[model samples]
Target: MTVLQSFPIPRPTTNPYLIMLGEALRRTPGVTVLNFSWKTALFGRYDVYHSHWPEILVGGRTPLRRLTRQALALMILIRLRLTRRPIVRTVHNVERPDGLTARESALLDVIDRQTTMRIRLNSTTRLPDGERFKTIPHGHYRDWFARYEPQEMQDGQIGYVGLIRRYKGVEGLVSAFRETEGRREGLTLRLGGNPSTSQLAASVASLADGDRRIELHLAYLSDAELVEIVTSSELVVLPYRFMHNSGGALAALSLNRPVLVPDNEVNRKLSDEVGSGWVHLFDGELTAESIITALDAAAVRADRPDLSARDWDRAGIEHADVYRAAIDAGHRR
Candidate 1:
């Protein structure tokens, strides 16, 4: 079967998940994959259109451009529908990364209605439409990222890495860190990620205001820098208000660092499934004290689960199943 990705990538440079999955897919026997281009999509023949981030087509820096892109994407959707090809959207987040706007939400509703299949990273991921969605666990980064020896929990380092945005609960992290600073001696907080927007950068910077114990590197860090942060840290926090699944947590665990996350259903499922000393869940209003308690659990993690089941090879096989299922469903339609 031939599969066309919704977005074009000649090579996967950034997202390690994509890199790993693409490599696995390429290795899969009797499977052909094509990088997506609008013109190629129009003329190219394929059995399935698999999209990890369909929002990328519509999302932009400005509202006007975003709307314009959405209009063009709608036309593309219609073209795909006319071609009678199956569309598979991989649900990375239950909501948009930048927060779902009303217009964006409506656009997603259309996509949901038109979609033949929706692939979620985990079983606990909620679906807007239940008829077509299924879960395939996210592959770990152990094979992709540079392997580093795990460091001891010197000074109780608590780290957060990924794009900094309001939805990420950075304010809560800063406040919680400040509140815990007094009781936990030598506990340091380090946050590294490019802020989603310029205004978000300025606002979040103020939260760190001259705190010696807290270090803020609010820019995109290289892989080595990311490794340094994860390797040195005692534990990492997702700190998302709500998330379907997190590659960041997997990255931390791949480097042998435990993770703390909010007690949402998807997160809880990840905790139970990953079941290494990997996850420490927090309940009802995460405050400084709660974070401290979670850290204490991380401090004494003697056994961490080896998440070998979530490798790229397994993900690729699972994804193949989804694509074939979509093809079958399209035939039925």
Candidate 2:
């Protein structure tokens, strides 16, 4: 079966999950991936259309470009319905992205109604009522960064990497770190990734004021640099305001580093799956005590986080099965 993915390979800003999934599908026995393009999406030959984040298709840097993309999105939606092609959307987030224009929201609503199957990264993800879905655990990053030289774990380093968005609560993380007793023990905080806005960067900087131990690499990190930041830390902290599933958390575990995240059913399941001392959870908002307690857990973690359940080969096969099932359902209809 041939599937057209809404992601481009070899794009510098492309997420590693998309890149790895494309490769996995290519390696599968009877599956083919038709890389996305405006020309391909509107006119190309493929069996099923696979969308990861459909919002990007209708967004642009300027109003004129945004309108143009929105027009294209509408055209593509019409073409998909006319051709009777099924769409498989991977549910990365349960909620519709915030800050969508009315037109964009309506377009996505149509896309959602037209969707054939939904792929959830975890079983705990609640779908819209009675939506047909399958749980395909997000794959590990162990194989993707295998070629990079590993960074030695630092004793008292706590690191946060990935896009610096307000919803991610980087400022809260810095504030909590500042209040931690670990600072007297030489515990350091490293912040990487470009901030979503200058104001957000300034806010975090203000929080880190006069603190020499708080290192900031407020820029986009290459794969090697991301690896260095994550692998070098004894503990990784992700203090998101809300998180059901995170590729960042999985990446840290895949690199054999423990993570501290908020306490929730998804995280509790992750902790149970990966084993003790790997996933430290805190109740309510992150605090100084949470950082110190999780850091202590990181200190004595004897074994690597178990990521055997996140194999890419298995993901590829499962994805193929989903595509086949969607096609068969289309035929029956």
Candidate 3:
């Protein structure tokens, strides 16, 4: 009943989903969780190999370099397939395709066809080569919710968390916060999270330079710091330009803090299902003035209980089941 689990460990990045998966595996009898590495994992002996987010491995590299790496990884995966060892891949972000060259895409296509099981967070993701794909909702760190103490509703503090990417709409938040100038009572925007790129950092800093109220921590945040920021904030807003599923939104809800997100089809579905009125639906007209108006309104209704107790526990258990199903299916084949 021994199982080998391999997942990427990115530095200065705390993947709560990966950590939760490892914890779930540890709880299961006769499962061995192994750290994922290129050279080691390819050669390691195991009953089952579960890889997370194959898209990321193909992304963020130069075209030539990405092609080369994909070829190498594909070769290893092909060899593993020939051995008939069960391999399962979990697709974390199916909302966006990996920036891959034609060759890399074809290579991944091959692997996807051969892989025994494909796990996805959302049920809507299409399977590659008509392979077996299962739906698994992402999990949150259970301890993150325990550390939160609801702060007194103060007038000026707003919090935003998650990887500070341009698409995340941090600039929109900054613009909206600026519009609140002189109109609201001491409005301050406290941004805490990892910035994916230097361009994003510079962009945020440039906006925050003159404004003392806008405090941006352009560094990797620990779990404790995350708890502190989320719990202390008056309201948490996820002003994403386009978001598939927000880990930030779930984290905020786990802390009993309300979240304000754009009213997209995906977000609206999640908000409605969770019964959390915390979501602020913004149509295509998200100007600085419009956003400020929304923020002002949210300040008053921030304490409204939007999320139901059912949605929270259901998300966690669904994730646990995905892991178990992957393992069980491996044994079956």
Highest-scoring model, lDDT: 2
Taken over the whole model, the C-alpha lDDT of each candidate is 0.79, 0.90, 0.67
lDDT of 1 by residue, 213-314 (tens): 889998998787788887788888777776557788888888778888888777776767767457888775568887788877776654655787787777
Full candidate order by TM-score, most accurate first: 2, 1, 3
User: C-alpha displacement of 247 in model 1, angstroms?
Assistant: 1.7
lDDT of 1 at 220: 90
Higher-scoring candidate on lDDT, 1 or 2:
2
Task: Please give me the total number of clashing residue pairs in predicted model 2.
Answer: 0
TM-score per prediction, in order, is 0.88, 0.96, 0.79
- 203-260, model 3: which lDDT tens digit per residue? 8888777888888888878777777787777668788887776788878767766677
| Cα-lDDT of candidate 1 | 0.79
Q: How well does candidate 3 match the true structure in TM-score terms?
A: 0.79
Q: What's the ranking of the predictions by lDDT, best on top? A: 2, 1, 3
Report the poorest 10 consecutive residues by lDDT, candidate 2.
179-188
Report how far residue 168 has shifted in candidate 3, in Å: 1.1
